[model samples]
Target: MTLSISARFAFETDQPTDVLLQFEAAAIPEQRIGKANTSLTQAEHCARVPAEDDIGERIWLRSQGRFDVEYSAEVTIERLLPDLGTLEALSPHEMPGEAVKYMLDSRYCPADSFQSFVEGEFGGTLGGARVDAIRQWIADHFDYAPGSSHVNTTARDSFIERRGICRDFAHVLVTLARASTIPARYVACYAPRVEPQDFHAVAEVFLADPTVEGGGAWHIVDATGMADPAFTAKIGVGRDAADVSFLTSFGPSNFLFSEVRVEKL
Candidate 1:
């Protein structure tokens, strides 16, 4: 069975920003059963109406953006539980649970940073509790305020600051995940609910086939909505937020006023 959902996405930035919009998924992820597609106007202001073949699982429109400017992408999710085993086996020691060497080597994710409170206290490997721990920590420690940090805010900065937006939250998670020997990546996209799409962040962990979760193995964890209830729908994932940031402007510009409004429609 599959489910279908349609929504509109819109946003404004504080300054003139170039944006890169992504709305594509490798395949369905985890329990998310079916797939859906989208249609939009030429100007990319509105999402016409989405279409779906089967109707069952939680199907909805997702988007991602950055500071570039006006940008958007319409994506569909087909087959929620994708065969991540292949990717898991192929990915190097970039994420968690695969290798401590690479994780330790990373200047961003040091060995000391990962703690028992993250592993034993949390639960299993990065695939299990790592993502949750980061989410909980960010929610508990940080304050949801923009302008706290700029685009250059590093993982360490966010951790020490304990106050940032979605991008900062994702960087912190990525840093921690790497410390735990988990091959983690970054993702950026839009969360479409009642209103338009807005920028969001998340982390992904690569693990071997455990002979469980239906497939031989799978990658799990979406921190975008972990701290906040507003970001419900999943949109995209990558090596980091930078990889998925929409709108890459060529020249220099300035921002007049930027704002984002989202509501279920």
Candidate 2:
């Protein structure tokens, strides 16, 4: 499937501010790209930084006064959904070195705090069954309220409040999976049919497949149930939202407006 994605950001700053932006589609093996462009108004000293995951790329820029940035891309992506029934949770020692980190706690997803709860609820279930149960549990309990969660909201906070956005949902799911000894990570994506047409957050779990030689594969999971896997374009992967935020500013900058549009072709 091919998708056209575009985003615009406007900000106002009293003095020059340094900004790090990760708004581009990731260059994963499953995705192909055509012509793409990015522009920044009233900005100086812009540079591109390769992401640690070797997937998405980030842009750093310095801007003063009124600043505007627009990015547009044409991408074709192949969605690969895992066969849940054939997946199993691997032991910590069996997991790859890179996958081991995801099983640990992060800033937003404190897996240790939820160990008892996760074990009590999902101890008996293993593999894809456990993942499906976790997804359903979150979707059933949490209310998808936009203004209910803040940047500092953690999985425990969202669990107690029973409300949050896509990122919050992903955080809670990732935490619970990790608590159950499952390797899970957060994913930033451009999802089609998202009501608000904004960047989306999802989760991916490394499930052990008997057929695979080493260990297993990362399976895309959306606890929020808002994104269509077939139309989603991955932007980045990380332990949590902190590592994959679309934009970050070092100095105080008033966000004027932002907009995202995705079209299927």
Q: What is the TM-score of each candidate against the true structure?
A: 0.54, 0.95
lDDT of 2 at 196: 83
Candidate with the greatest lDDT versus the true structure: 2
Off by over 4 Å in 1: 1-127, 193-197, 208-220, 224-236, 255-265
Q: For model 2, how does the per-residue alpha-carbon lDDT over 19-124 read when each residue is reduced to its tens digit? A: 8888889878778877799888857768889864677898888888888889899989875666765677787888878898899999999999898998788777
Look at candidate 1 and tell me the lDDT of residue 33: 20
Give the alpha carbon lDDT tens digit for every residue of 1-265 in model 1: 2223333444444443333344432233332423445443233232322211111121222232322223222333232344432333324423234232424423333435555545664455344455556656667777756778886777777777887777777777777766655656555434443222345566555565555442323244454354222233345444455445433333343334333333333
Overall lDDT per candidate, in order of appearance: 0.46, 0.87
Off by over 4 Å in 2: 209-211
Alpha-carbon RMSD, each predicted model: 9.3, 1.5
